[model samples]
Target: MNVQSKYSILVFNRENELFLPLTEFYYYQQKRINESSALSYLITLERFFSWLAKSSNYQGTRVKWSDSHMAIRTAVENYLIYQMGCKLRSKENFQYVIMTKKSPQTINHFLAAIKSFYKTALHLKLYEFQNPLVDADYSISIGSFSPTSIRENKPRLPKIAGTEIPSDSSYRSQSDSYFKLVANDWKPNIIADHDLPYIIYRAGSEIGWSLRDEVVIRMLFETGARINEILELTLGDYRQRINQYEIATLNKGSEKRRIKFLRFSQDTLKLLMRYVNGERKTYAHEKQTFTKLSDSEVIFLTRRGDPYNYNAFYSQWSKIITQAKIKMNIHKTRHWFVTNMIRNIYDTASDGGEIEMKKNELINYMKWKDPETIKVYEHYFNEALFREIHENMAKKMQEYEKEYLKKSHSSSEGEQLSSSVLQTKAILPTEEIEWINEFYKGME
Candidate 1:
């Protein structure tokens, strides 16, 4: 469909017949899945389709794909060959750079996108083809194609055999696996323990901030919640439950869970209640963009009495971090919370005392999907935490030993002094002693 050099989505052709089903598939996911999660699928779909439109084998001087017959195996093979020879343009440091081929992860994304498209399209009866991506081991079904298990959800995508990859621009086939590119490893900057208090204190130092801002900062530290999760907290979560204060929140994954502030006392809850009763309404008074504060039920509001969006929250966070002069960011607070909890609990468990920290407990507290990801990515996942905790416990034990020795010396002197005092009291006149005691009581 070379109707134009550019592909107009509005104009349909046999080429579009190939692309439309995939567009519909991802669009359906965007509507159903969380928007943030769906964005990746949508981006990948567009990239794959755009490549298909431009690829020489797929679209070279072709008017209609529906008119010309192509087998699924031929389509997949041609696409894979094109990918190996593809040179991509990107801007880095204000300069353009051409990449020889896509990374392995990107190559895998293409496979996943096409596989999902074909599977979904076939199921909906939108179109049908012999899907070359499917292995004989698994039966494809549209009615129940979605996997429930985490393992099944993340099944390894089949890669195009290295033998099929083109060696040069001439399209000579290569039997080697030299074209694959690996994804960079994730390395998070660890946040220190004391950084949180300094940040919160600095946040409070700012003028025109009601308890709403303070609550936002404190709740983030207290719950180890993501910023979006705290921002989305509703007034309904603040309602009293069974004579106790509790807050329910939805995390990044859209999993709703309750946070009972046991670590933070009722006094902390009182600060929140105070905000609800008075400070929430007061935000509108100081805000230039003030409107009806009742419009949004979200707990955290901006100076405009509008809900705290990502931009507003990040801006406020940047100001606080700048004033605090700390190397930590917002997410580092979550890291700080978990790291300190694990370290402190481990330090307390010395000398055969039962360990209060548990993997399952951390998973539930942080509202993580599973233990594996947290282990692989979070603070407690590394042996560095164990080393830090062990060192902390050793220092605490030494301090305790010094205090015990000092107490023992004081006790010895006190025992002798007590004996002398008893002797002196025995020798004193009972009436005089009683009189002195009564005089002291009268003064109190």
Candidate 2:
């Protein structure tokens, strides 16, 4: 027999089956699967192979390329069951090994891959056994769904603990004090130059990341775009719309939408434009490869000029977060931006007693649907403003009372009314108090 035929026969014999070239079939199957899915299959197969190599059935000898088909199939089935049992016990903390959640989709995928392998072996005449993965029964009750079902049926709302009105002033004071404490406690040891974008870019570069990494980070922080959405961005996704940048792209699940970036993010946008126009354009021109440079080309690229993969970005981000000594994940930068922006909006509204047209336009541009979504910021704003107003009014009233007492030795009815008005306005709005009193027919 020729070298190719001999090698094929040996490969078939190793699995103890007859009639198939497993490696060739695997290559064909891989071509049908996406890169991500193919990688998952390869990982699973490696684990299975490792277990098989360590099994006592092999008798400390390597299984020949031409192994007994029935024996190989039985061994594989036993290994699968053992793995499932182990996984179930591990997930349930050993409390009940038989009552662990086993995903049908995962098991089905494993079975499918193994069945495909056996089919290929049979086609090549390398093995004579029936597909064991398909024949084996995997219908075992791993666990109860009671906990998950209960969680799904539970109501979603914050439970209020007390009847007392939560003073806006008190809330603001507490929030400010808490943020100040946290910020002070976790201050970075290495003082970064506050040149903003330049500092951020250099920090990213220091960690061996490309210019694209800096752009992605800035976009996440400034626009609050989810990480997956940022990865999906293409060169043509961004467009200049008057003073701001509008990014039209698909989100995680391929949901297409538009998001507007404020003028404050201009510097970051400019850097991205520079990188694309200067570096990206030049590289594509020099390479002159079959792939044409277009807006459809991925926005982010690796050092080698290839498209940036999500997994690679995540690994790098974890390391960077650790190095930076950030108490939260990188995604917290997005939360910080959203929270601060809402706080600013609330402050402006409280100061003016109404939302300005310009401020309203900006809020709309950000695509927030409900005013209540910004209520957290309002809570903080109300608390701070109320406290300040009350403290100032109280001090003024104390002065007025002292002056009146010195002149007349007692306050008149009018003086008492004025004092009452000041104190009443300090706590609740005049209109709200009057409405309440009217509704109650003068009840205290």
List TM-score per model, in order: 0.45, 0.41
Most TM-score-accurate candidate: 1
The residue-by-residue lDDT of candidate 1 on 388-418, one tens digit each, is 7999999988986786577677678677567
lDDT of every model, 2 decimals: 0.52, 0.50
Task: Report the C-alpha lDDT of model 2 over 60-92, residue by residue, as the tens digit.
Answer: 454432466545654554554566432222221
Local error of candidate 1 at 425, Å?
A: 53
The root-mean-square deviation over C-alpha atoms between each candidate and the true structure, in angstroms, is: 19.1, 17.1
Q: What TM-score should be assigned to candidate 1?
A: 0.45
lDDT of 1 at 56: 33
